[model samples]
Structures are given as C-alpha cells and as structure tokens.
Target chain A: MFSLLLQSFVCCRFLSSLWLSQHSVVCLLLQVLLTHITISNSQHNTPNPTMMKSIVARAYSPFCSVFATEDCDKLANDLGYEDLITLLAPHGDSVGRATVRDSQGMTNTYDDFAIRLGAKRPTERDSGGMLFNPDAMEALLREYIGHYNSDDSAFARFFAKLVAAPPDTAFETFSQPAAHLFCVSSRNAHPLDTLQALAQGQKRDKDCLNFYVLVHDARVEDAENSTQRTIALLERAKKRFGLAGMIKLGQEGVPETIPTPQFLTVGDELVNLKTGVGFGSRTLSQPDKESIRSLLREFTVQHLIPHMERCIMTWDTVAAGKRGLTGRMFSAGKKWLKFGGSEKQEAGSSIQASGIYPQGSPEQTIRRLADYAFMLRDYRYAYATYELVKRDFLSDKAWKYLAACQEQAAVALLMYTTRLTEKQRVEVLNPLLDSACYTYISRLQLPQYALRMLVVTSDLQCLLGPDAASQGATQWFQKLLDERLVGRLGYALIMLRVSYAFSQSPKGRKAALWQLLSAREWADANQKGEMAKCLDMTAPVYDELNWPNNEGTLLTRLKGELANEAKPTSVAS
Target chain B: MSYYLAIVGTEDNPIYTQEFGTYRQGGDGNSRFSPEMKELAPFILHAAIDMVEQTASRTNQLYLRTVDNFYSHLVSAFVTAGDIKIMLLHETRNEESIRQFFQEVHDLYVKTLLSPFYFVNQPITSPVFDQRIKSLAKKYL
Candidate 1:
C-alpha cells in the first residue's frame, strides 16, 4: 500500500503541476482582457470626450474598430447625452459619426446652425454653461448704445439698436429710458435724401431705424414761400410721426443790423417759439433801434400781448401838468378804448376782443402801459401814467416807475426854474423835491436808479446851502449816504456835496474843511486805478495852489489814503 | 375743392394761386368756384403760411382746419414746415368725400413736382401739371 501510495503521489504531483500551469495561463489571459476593457473605458471617460473623439477620429481611418467598439452608453453618460444631442441637432452633419451616433440622431432646432455649433451647454464636464451671463449682456448692450454721440446717423443707429433690442435690455442699458432715435443734422445735405435713406432702411428691416431729418440753414426760395414750406414740412412730420419726430429747417446766422421792421417781423415769426432775443451785456451797451425793436417786439408779441392787451396805456402826468384834464384823460383813457369803438362809446364794452387780444383785462393793460411809459424819455407823461397805475399796483413795477418819474420830473422842474416865481417855487419845487427825495431814499427799487437819484439830490442840497429851506434835503442826503443804498461812489459824492454846502455857509469854514477832508478820503479809497493815476497827475497842481492853508498836506494825506485802499479781493455776494 | 396755393418768401411776401373743383365718385370735375375764394386767395395763402410757420416750431403738428372763412369759403393748410403746401377751401357738395379728393390732389402734386425743374413754392402754371391735375380730377371725381 506504501509503494502504491508513493506511485500515486508521484502521479498526483505531475497532475497538480499541470493544473497549476493551465490555471496561471487562463488567469493571465483574463487579466489582459480586463485591462483592455478598463483602458478603453478610461480613454472614453476622459474630460472633453468630444475633443478626444475628434482627435481620435482625425488620426484613425473610418473603419477604426477602436472607435466602433466605444461604449457609447458610458460615453454619453460622461459627456451629457442631452447636451450632445442639443449641440449636434443644428450641425449633425458637421459632427463626427461617432458623436452623431452618441447623440442618438438628435438635430439642432435653432435656425442658425453655425450659431448652435458655436454655442456651449453646461455639462458635468464643463465648469460653466454657454448661456449668456446677465452681466455680460449688460456690458455688451452698454458698449453698443454708449456709442451714441448725437450725430444724426449715430443717433439713428443708437435708436435702431435700442428698439431692436429686447425692452428689458434697453431699459437696463440706457440712463435716459425714453430717448428716441430722432436726430437733427446741421450739415448741408438735402433733407429729402436723408429722409428717403432712413425710410428705405427702416422699411427693409421692420425694426431697423426710426429717423427724423433736420435741414440746418435750409434756404427757402423766398420768405413767404419758405414759411409756407416750413409749415407744410411740420404738418407732414406731425401727421407721419406725431410729435415724436420733427425736422427743423434752421436759418443760419442772420445779420445783426437788420432794419427795425424786418427785425420786428422776424421776431414776430419766432414769437411762436417764445425764444427771447439773446442780447449779451455788450449788445445792451450800444443797443440800436433794431435791437431795441427786436427786444420790444419779442417782449410784446411773446410775453406782453399774449398775457396783456394789444394796446399799452400810460397816463402822462407831466403832460397832465401842462394840459390838465385832456392829458390825463388821453393818457389813461386810450388804454380802455376798444379796438373798433370810440372811447366814450366803448367805456363799458367788453375788454375781450375776440381775435385782437386774449388777456386784455384792465389790470394787464394798465401794467403793460405803465411799463411802456417808464421806458419813455418824457418823465412828465411817465409820472402821470405811473401815478394813474400806482393805486392799483402798489409797491411793484408800477409803483417803482411812478417814483422814478416823480424824481425825474422834480429834477427837470428844478433845472428850468426861470419861469417860476418864489411862491410857485416854494409851492411846486419844495414839495416836488421832498417827494423826489422820499422816493429816492425810501422806495428806490433799482440800484443804478437809486445811485443816480442820490447824486442829483446831494447836488441840489449843496446848491441850496445850509439855510432852513435846504435843511430837509440836507438831512435826507446824509441819511441816504449812511444807509449805503448807494455804493462807495455815491457816498463820496454825498460827502463832497455836504462839504461844499458847509463851505458856502456863513461861519461854517471849519465844518466845511472837516467835511471836505472826509470826502477826499472816501473819494481816494474808492478811486479806480485809472482815476487814481489821473488824480496823481493833477495832485501837484492842487498842492501848489494851496487855496486852503496846509492844503498840500491834506492832499498828500488823500494820496496816502488812496494807497491804503485795498484792491477788492471778493465780489459782492 | 377750391385750392389756394401760396409761396411765402423768407421776407413774408406772399405769391398766391388758386383752383376750384370737387373731384369725387361719378361727379363732374368742374365745380362753380366761389368769388369769395378767388378774392381772398392771397390772404388765405398768406395766413396759411403764417400759421404753418407758427405751428412748425411747436412740438405738435395738426392741420389747422378752416382758420379763416370769407362767406362760404374756408381756408385749410397741410403744412410740411419746410416746403410749400397747397391750401384748399370750398363749399363742398359732400364734406365727407372731400378728404379723398384732397388726398388725390396731394398725391398728384407730389408726383408732378418729382421732376427737378419743378422747385418748391413755384407757381404750378405748367400745361403738363394742368393736364395731370385734370386727369386726377377725372379719375377721382
């Protein structure tokens, strides 16, 4: 049994060895197959599988079994089957066969296949989706619309782009949300050509451009024809585009010195726009008749007539002083006269003239008339008109005009006193003077007018001296200077006048000198640089004369005072 | 339609022309022109130009209808605010149908002036224009 067992053991060893070797071979083959499968899966499962497939397809022939046997199910899962289908739908023919197969015969639904191809969709493999970001859309729209520079074409482009865009996009992009695409061109091009181009462009594309053409300096065949043409154009534009679009036919720069009637006529034409004539300060300095007429016409046609009456009424007080009842009646009466009726007959007639005037109420008429009278050179009439209107318009334009007229009339009466007797002088002149002074010192509305009145008042007081008759005027002048209603120049003039008055008085020499010294100092302090230079040039002569004892010393002190006068560093607030 | 055409020069001078007709469905092109329309043609044209200029600068545009009437004659303007217009006013046999006639006249006007020789606001006294006007009246009236 031992020998037999030994022989069987030898046989068993050989069988076992054979079995072990075969098992090893089988395991090795199985290991190789599994490794191959794993390698294939890894290659297919790589990031950007599409790119890798494209590369593999490019490198190998069409019959490459390696691609043929690709586990498309796994690949589809890795690459996002839905995304691939969406991407290939528009460009299935362009995509590789393997990709097309992987996409399950899906087709792009978008009309723009190229656009679809360019588009990217979010996938497990992709970090970000191909969908447009809100921020990026905003940036793009901003860049596009922000290019507007108000040029006609640029404006059209901007408008076209804006309206063509989604409403939400447009609102988010523009600061002015309601800005239209209309444009005005100041160039020398035919407006018709521009309009045709714009119309054609807009027609070609339903959402292309909405355009309005403006012809700058468009020359009309003639004035009458041109105005008619302009009206026609406006009407057409209105009908076509409502008020949203317009073409302005702007006449270029007109001559500054046109005739008064012509200027007035132009002003009347432009009155509809209510654009006031722009006269700079320099223009105001040398205002010609045409300029004044233009100004007046604009004021009347645009502001005054539309709000006031067709006729301006003024009560001529100075004329009233001479002509009595007739002057006052004519001055104030004509204002109330109806356009087509006699003054007496139209006394109670309706103020409203159907087409003649709109706001021809008595108050408006009186106010306008007062303004007209105030601007007139004849102070007598102006004063009367103002007085007539004053009771109605207290402490306003009418009151101010009345005061001015009164003051001016007083000055005139004083200047021409040869015809007046002492009684008349005392009766008319004194009251007039008092009224003038009171108005200047108390109710002077405008600074320039106040300054003028103050100068005249001081001069009159100086001429009258320190008598009881001049006491009221003197006190008023002093008060006015102290109040500073008048500026530094007025103050100096007042001081000089006071000094002269005191010097003329008996036993007033010492007071006169004090006043004169004060005047000199004020004058010196306020002297303009050019005026100071002139004074410096004349100083030596005054000093050499020495009409007053130590006058040279005083004059020198005046010069010193002038030198001490600081150059004004700040303007009045 | 009694048409009053005026060319207002830049200097406010008015050059006026007029024609009267009612071009409508199965109606005779010739209509009795009112003497008032003829007499007031210049004034009507001038006023239309004035109204146009006045309204052109405004932010609104609407044809001012029957601005002035002189005893059975009315003045109306279709302003372009840059070119001349043919204003029309007449006692229409049928007021409602006048709009269609007016539109036809306007189209003919626009077409006739399409030639370069015909400048804006120029008097339309051409025989060709007259023929076209007559033809348009025949077609529409």
Candidate 2:
C-alpha cells in the first residue's frame, strides 16, 4: 500500500516535467554520475585489499583431520578432540613459518600456513548429517572469503555471494583432508595400540600424510615421560603403519611430536563467531604457543606441503592424460557404450545412485585435483579442472554436482583473476552463476542455496570495478523478493540491499525511491530500527522534492510505532 | 480482448478516453473490463506515463511498445510531436494492430489539432470523432 502511494506520487512528479526539461536533468545527472565514476576509477578500483588478502588466506589454507580416540577425552578431563585441538592448535599467525615451492615451481614462504583441523574425515555420516551441509559450507565460505557487510557497493556484496559454493549434497569444495593427525594422550595406557587401531580404521589413501601426535597435559603429567613414550610410540607406528617406510623419513626427523596441552579457563556457552570456536579468546603462555606453532609449521613444511606438491604433480599428469584429446575421445566412447548398454537407465539415477562421483572415477579424481589446486592456491589450475569436470557432470545430468562445479569454477576464477573484461563476465561468470542458482532452486528444492548463491555472486560482482554490474546485482536482489524466497526479515534486508545497489547506480532518484520502498518493507516487517534507518537515508531526497508532508503521516505513524517499541509498557488492545 | 485508451496531453491532462471489447470472434463491441479493473485502468495508465517518458528518452521510435505493465495489463504507447501521449491499457499484446490503431488515431488527432475551433489539451467531445473511433475499433480491434 505504501509502495503504491509512493509510486503514484513519483509518477505524477515525473509526468509533470516536460521532455525538454527532463532531458536536461538527465544529462546533468549523468555528468555528476560520470564524475563520481572517474573519482572511483582513479582510486585503483579493485576489490578491497583486505578482502582480497583474506580470500587468499582462506582459500589457500590446507585441511587436516585431527583424530583422537575416546580415551583422549578421559585423559583431558572430558575435553574432547575439539577442545584439545583448540588448546594445542596454532591458529592464524601462530602457525609459525613454512617455506615451500608450489606446483608452478615458485618458491614462497608463509609465516602462517594454517590448516583447518576438522575432528574427523568426511564420512557417509557427514553426507546425511545437518553439520557441514551446503548452507553451512556457504556460510563458512563467506566468512573465509570476507564478509560483505561493510561493502557499500551492492555489486561487492553480490560478488561475495556469487563466488561462494552453492549448497551441494556432496561436500567437495574443501578437499578431503590431505594430512591426518592421529592424536593420543600419554595418559592412555596403550597409546600406540590406539593409534594403530585408528590408523587401520581409516581407508588409508596412499597420498594422505599421516602424523602421530602425543598430547600430554603439563599440569597433570611429566613432560619428559610423555616425550619418551612418544618416541617409543613413533617407533611402533613406524613399524606397524609403515608411514616411515612410505615417506622414507630420516632418523634425525621423526614424524611423531609431543604437544603438551596448556590449561586455559574460558567461559562456557561463549563462542568466537569469527573462528566458529566453542570459546572466546584465552591467552596462552608464549612458549606453549611457540611449541604448537613450530609443531604445526614442521607438519606443514615437512609433510603437508611436500605431500600436496607431489599430489598436484601426479594429478596434473593424470588430468592431462584424461582431459587431453585422446582421453576425451576414450571417455566419450566409453560413455557412448554405456549409454547404449543401459537404455533404461535414466539420467537421474547417475545423481541418485552416486551422491558423489564413484570412487576412483575420472570425475572424482579431477574434483580432488581441483580441490588440491585450490588448497595450494593454484587457482588457475583449479579453475581449469572445475571447467573440465563441469561438462561431464552436465552430460550426466548431475545437476547438484554440475552446480557445485559451476560455483567453484567461478570462485576460482574470481580469486585468481584480478580483473574481468565485460566479455568474460558475460560469457564466464554470468552463465555459470545463473545456471548454478537456477539448478539449486529449481532442479534441487534448495531455495536457501539459491539465496546464498545470489548473495555471494552479488558480493563478487561488487569486487569487479563497480559499474552497471550493480544494476545486475539489484535485479538479482529483486528476484529474491519476487520469488518470495526470503522471510519477512530477509525480505526487508534484501530490499535495503536493492536500495543500496540503486544508490550506487548513476540514477540518484531511483535510489531514493528504492530507499522509500525499503523503508516501507521494514515497517511491514515491524523492524523499527531498520525502518528508521531507511527513512533517514531517504530524508535528503524527500526534502529536496519537498515531499515531507506528503509522506509525513506514514513517517509520523512509523516513528510513533518506533517510539512505542522503545518503551517498556506499550500494550495493544 | 478489452482495452482502455486515453489521449493525455503534454500537461498530463486527459483530453480523450474510450473503452471497448473485441468486435471479432462472435463478440459484441462492448467493454468487458471487471468493475475493479474499470476503476483501476485509468490509474494504471497514469502510473505508466513515468515509464513511457523514461522509455521515450532511450529510443527515437514514436511507438513505444508495452512501456509498462500492471500484472497482466500492458500499457503500449505512442508519442506525438507536441509530447501528447496516447496510452492503451490492454489485456493481450497485439503489437502490429495496436501500432496501426495508434497510427490511424494519430491521423485523427492531427486532423483535430488542425481544426480552427480545437486547441491543445482540449477534450474531444465531437460525436463524429467518437463515431470514427468506434468504427476503427470495429474494423481493426
């Protein structure tokens, strides 16, 4: 109702102006808009430096699995693998220093090569479980890539949304952990036996690097005893697991290390939103921090980086073999034969039967290869791999898999390429994102994924030298509203986003109009704060047009409602 | 098909208005617009003027096909030299016929403007003009 009134009012104002006068106004508006554009362009109009840095930091981090037996919890006084890892883990800048050569043979030193340590490896349980779902992945990706909250440009927010992974049933964006840490407490009587048992339980892919961690509590146990036991356990693990034989470790450098857990008191029920940790910041002793740091650094430099480098080399060759002309023909022939052999097998079964690609298949290998390249920050290679595999998924009609590939492919390109030409944006990012969002919403019944997709895509778009892309971003936001995919609060929020998008566009009045509409939406959603904010933003525009009295009643009523909301005792009849 | 046509002058005053149903396919030449739509169609055309003006700036073509829409009702427009807008609020899109209708109406409008008694922004109350419009609606609508 408010929008209808506002629209008519705006239309009437527009209608009253003669074409000659309006044309002159449009020309003046364009000149002012062009001046603003020139100023922004002169300021090195790339994405925010911090945002790019954070995206690189997040995307390049390797994943590792920390496996602790149930006995480790008993030793740590009910502190499970998560708490123990948290206490002994080196996070962010504390991960010490590591020097490694990438697959491209460029030597780079990282003082903070951090690995995201998950408690367990990806299992069938995680596939069906609520944890680590597509929405969760999208949220986590947004956090890592950089939050879009501070960006004023609507395209920046949209780009952030576009480049993040779409919700997929198969969790493949973050690669399967390349390094597995088997952690055992010294208090456990048969630590070696538990390590052996746990190691045996794993499907022990040959490429994965296994590290044995002996965790001891400084407050409870003797550090020397734990170190000696760790040495003995390493010898046993070397004999039983054959990790030493596999990697050909030198006698001077043992894979096993003792990390003494330092106690820190943190309030329960408090979480660090940024890190998504169970507890907030707790200061650690400098030496303890250094010890954990050096341990992780050694783990990354000696085992993790080298292993990843080797894997990339091997996968590159294998991918070249498979994706090359002959390999493509061979695969095409194989697929054709399969198509002829199974006349009754519908395309849907390919997705339903193998929720993920069948193990050891070319698609799985390529995806794994892409994941590793992404982890290694070889984004070009990762983007190419994603592009290569996207077609296979498309032909198989694996919509979810195809969408995931498309999302990752776009993200990889966005992360690596600093600037995209108009042609690339239209040809590459646009179609990839459109298909991904469409498939997520239509093929799959995951509107949440579509929302995330649009949100991320808009953020990524904002990064690419803001221009008419904001208009495209606004259209996507409008689509979210039109589809009714968002809740009332989300609707109000996205409407404000649309307003912001328009505000960044050349047309100032359209921005004011959207702001008015957004204010109405906020009022409808009963969000007094946001409604007041939007009204405040639109105030100057209305004042310019002398429309205060025309909108005064609605604004006064809304302000009154806000005042009532602020008070404690406002009961409605 | 139901259509509501309005001839709005440069100052956005309604100079002429008509409503009619399709005369083809066994239909009587009477408007079948819903009572709610009958009340709303004028406002719809009024609201669409903003869109018409915006579209007019982007293109040189006088016939701005379907400038705006309110749900299923599309507003097609034709602009004259003096900035008089002839807007049609219609249910179905008949681009060529509407373009032809707008062209013939433009001729009639020019003839009306050329009259010594007629003036710009003056309402058309001539019965002969009304009869010609009804006949045109029957011939091509």
Candidate 3:
C-alpha cells in the first residue's frame, strides 16, 4: 500500500512535469486524484490492483472500444477515448490483453474486452472556424468533470474503473472448436455502437467457426431490458433458420468444460423419430452446407459428445443409487426419429420437433449419427450404430444408401477396430463386404461403382488384411457376366480389369484378345451387340500417344467394329 | 556411420532433431542404432553442453571440433552469435563435412526465424526443415 502511494507520487510528478496540459486543469485533476486516493484507501482493502503504472499505453483488439458516439458524447461530452488511445496504442499485430485476477489468482482474461474510454473536443471551432486554444479545452474538461462528479455517480464509477484498469495482458486462451462462441466488436465506436456493430458486422463475415454471438455493450441502466432485446433478436434468427438454442439450465446443469451449443441453426431438414414431425424452415446453400458439415464435425467432437458422456455418467450414477434420476432424461432415451408413426402430434415432445437432429427416418438418423461418429473417429460407436441400422435396411429397395452405409462402416472398422480378427473375416467382414458388392450390382444397378469399391478398398490391402475380401470379392465382378446381368458398361469394366491385370506379363497379348472373345461368348447370341459396346467404350477414350502399343492395336480393331456398326445405325435412325 | 543431429536453443530446449545412417556404402539411409545407443543419443548430446559453454566463453570461434565423447559416441558443437547451439553426435568423425552441414542448417534456421508465425525459443514444427535436416544428415553425416 505504501509502495503504491510512492509510485502514484512519482506519476503525479511526471503528470505535471511531462504532460502538455494547461496549468489550472492539472491543479484541479491533482485535487480530484488526491480525493480518489483517499476514497480508495478508506472504501476497500485489496492488494492486487492491476492499476496503471507511469507508462500510459493501450492495446488494440478486434473488440477494442474508443467510446466515441452521440450517446458517449452525452456521457463525457468529447471525442471519447482519443487521448488514451493516442497515449497507449502498443506496437505489434499481437496486442496486449487484460487478465481478470480474482482472489484465486488468475481466473480469467478479457483479451477482447479491454475497452479504453476517452473524450476530446472537436478540432474545428464554431466561432468563425478559428483554431481552438488548450486553455479553453481545459476549462471545458473541468466543468465536465464537475458535472460528472455531482449528478451521474454511475458514469464517475465507470470512469474510475477505466482509469484503474491495466492496459494489455498476455494472450492465453482455450483452443475450442471454430463454432463455439463468436466475439464481435466495432472498429471505432463507443461501447453502445460497438455492441450493435459487432452483431451487425458478424452477420457479414460468414465464418462457420462459432454459433453464439456475445456482444459487450455499454449498459449503465436498464440492463435487463438490453439483454432481453439481444436474446429476442437471436431467437428470431433461430426461428428463421430452424436454429435451436439448447435449453439453458442453472449453474448445476451446465458443465464448465463443454461449451453450450448456443444459437445453432439446423442447416439441413431434420425429422423426429418419436414425434414423427419434419422440422426445417430453410435450406442452407451448398458452400454453407460444406461449412456447416465441418462445424458439425468439430462441435460433435468438441462439445456434444462430451456433454453426452457427462449425461451418461449421471445415468450410471442414478443406476448405482449414488444419485437420484434427474427429471429431464435428455435425448438419449428419446427415439430421435419415427419411421412409420403418424399418430403423434408435433406439440407432443418439445425436443422431437426442434430440428436439432438431422432430418430423416430412424434409420437415416442412425446413419447420420453413425457418420458423425465416424468423422469424430469413434469407430466403435459408428460400427455399433451401423450394425443396428443395417439390419433394418436389408431390403432391396434401400440398396443404394444402405450399401453406402455398409461400405462406410467397413472402412470405419478397418481404421480403428481391434475387434476384427482373422477368424472374424470369414464369419463377419466377408459377408458384409460381399453384400456391399452384390447389392450395388444386382439391386442398385451401379456395377462400376460397386466393382471400384471392391478393387480399391479390399484387394490393395491384401498383405495386411484377410484374404477373404481379396480372393472372394473378385467373384462378384465375374458373376455379373456369368449371370448375364451385365450391360455394355459392365462388360467393358471386366475386360478393362483383365487387361490391366495382365499388362506386364509375357502372355498379356493373348490374355487381352482371349478376354475379348470371352466377353463375346458371355453375350451369348448377342455377341454383335456386346462387340458394339466394347467399340463405343474405347472410341471415346482412344488417344494415340497416351495408349500403350498392345492396347492401341486392340483399340484399333474396336474402332473398325464401331465404324461397321455405325453404318447400320445411321440407316436405322 | 550413424549420426544423431539436434538443434538446441539458447535455453537448452530442442528445436529440431534427426537421425540417419551412412549412404556411402550399399546401406539404406536408416539409422542402424542399437537400442541402448538410440536411447543414450540425446543424453550424450545434452552432457556435452558444459563443454560447449566452457568452450563458447573462452573462444569466439563458433565451431568447437570434437568437444566431448562418451565411449564410441563423438559429439561436435557449433554455436551461433545469437547463442543457438547446434550439436551432432556421430560414431565416426569428419570435421570439414560437419562444418558444411552446420552452415547449411544455419542458413535454413535464419530463414525459419524470418517466418512471422514463429515465436521465440519454441520447438520447431516445420516439416520442410525436418526434411532438409534429414537430407543433410544423409548427405554429410
């Protein structure tokens, strides 16, 4: 305390000796300072002050406030924050921040909230546009200070807080996901303007990182009304975009580690399984969907899953009689989407119609949730969800999407599962991967896509993985020809694979020609028709310089066959 | 010859490290270190810091040739003007090639320091620098 007094004494000497201000105002300010010190000594007994030293410097931030506006003018009556900013703007792209040191040492640091308030006279004078004098300005400040001291005690308190606050603090923040909490502030405005501009400017930067917008507005009075208005505006945006603000609970309900999923919009149409209600008002654009997908991936990783784990722990403790079951049983037990239920009304469950989950049937919701699990690299969860959903989607009609899901599940398990033993391959993985191939060809009619998945995913990793996918999977492609299920494209695909396989061998030449003959025989009585497809396939892709000599010669023969077939097609058309 | 190269900052924190074996023979550029030697490599380099400080204080020469040794492991030191110490632990010794390797790395270091994203006295995470150090070890070490 004595040291602080001595430091202030030295600063007072520096204030008078160094500062280029008028004499009378300095004397007045000194008197005000002395009274402030006496009041501070009597009113509070504290050690850690974060008080200003002899050096007067300020740090710039994205949310830094100058407090210069019509409202600010009415409060302090000059160009606000100009003097303080001019006095203390530091040198670096990286500015200093303020740390909120509680009795517990360092609890928080408002790096973006170190607001500097200032007031200065306009450069131009009203009387004949004459140059202003420093003496008159000093008198105006003196009168303003006196007025501030008498009627508006709140304004004086704000000023006192501003003066006592430290300039810049170091930057050390939690590395949360991009879509957690977005902070917005004005470039050059008062606290009121900064608050409004931050909200307004944030709507323009279109970043998908954070969902919640936190505004640091100046509130001298009617604080409740200001907060209500802010929330109302956010609520309106939420309704428009099918956004949901997670139901906020009191201190005990909300965990400190996981950030609250606030003001998040459902970028895609989502449905409820329990209530059977489709809930989406608007569709996000393509790029918006991409960004939202990334944000969803990050948020599920950062916040949602952690919160889910906490809830699960609560459930576990309740089961063990360590804690009673909470009245709210979260969305875990709630069937997220209803596939066939049409009786349940929209208003039955508040959560079911909220559009927080992705829009689909129960199966789709499971698939999407599994995908999110896959994206977060929780393969076990994904595999479990996929296993459950795959049973319901075994019908031939849902082959396309179901096959896609099955493939994703296989890949996810391949990456992270220690459960997949070599014994398990014959019993489990082979049948699953075989079905993934069979469904695509026989049911979905997209043979090439199925064949590629077989070739690329399973066969290449033969050395490391089981031989079941490698040796057994090739029969699916051959079966397309054997069962007479293949079209022009499928035949071409098989031949191409055969040629690619033998391209390096001494018998590569015979194999290519023999495969061509085998393709024709598989066409049965329609060898001519199959031959035309083979010609059509190679003609479009034929390039003299790009193709190898042996493939070139075979392609040349196909060109001849194509020309002969085209002559008749011209007559028919 | 197997070599372990480490770039240590003024505060004795590691900035970058790489291990490589000789490409002179028909050997692949994989460090043929025994399990114990691989574990002891970092400690052997660290133990040479006292010798480095003693030599650094006495002479203005940045290059301190064959400063310290532990059994078969020979440690060489190169100190920059800014006090960034670069040390290399090798089973076989060659002075001229070591100086050339240090010079090339120093150039890369200067360029790396010029990057605005880099903070002072931090661990080097640049993959390009890692690659360069490995290639330099393969070439000279």
Top-scoring candidate (DockQ): 2
Best by lDDT: 2
- Candidate 1, residues A232-338, lDDT tens digits: the string is 66467656654322222223443232211111112221331233221211111122223223322332223322221122212222223324677456545645554
Error of 3 at A146 (Å): 81
Candidate 3 CAPRI level? incorrect
Q: Please state the error at residue A173 of candidate 2 in Å.
A: 5.6
Clashes per candidate (backbone, < 3 Å): 37, 22, 16
Runs with alpha carbons beyond 4 Å of true place in candidate 1: A1-228, A231-371, A374-378, A385-426, A436-479, A493-519, A522-544, A547-552, A560-573, B1-141
Model 3 TM-score, 2 decimals: 0.25
CA lDDT scores, all candidates in order: 0.36, 0.63, 0.43
Residues B14-129, candidate 1, lDDT per residue (tens digit)?
Answer: 32343545555444565555553343344334434444554455635434444444335565555433455545555533333444545665666677568898766655666776
Residue A533: error of model 3 in Å?
A: 23
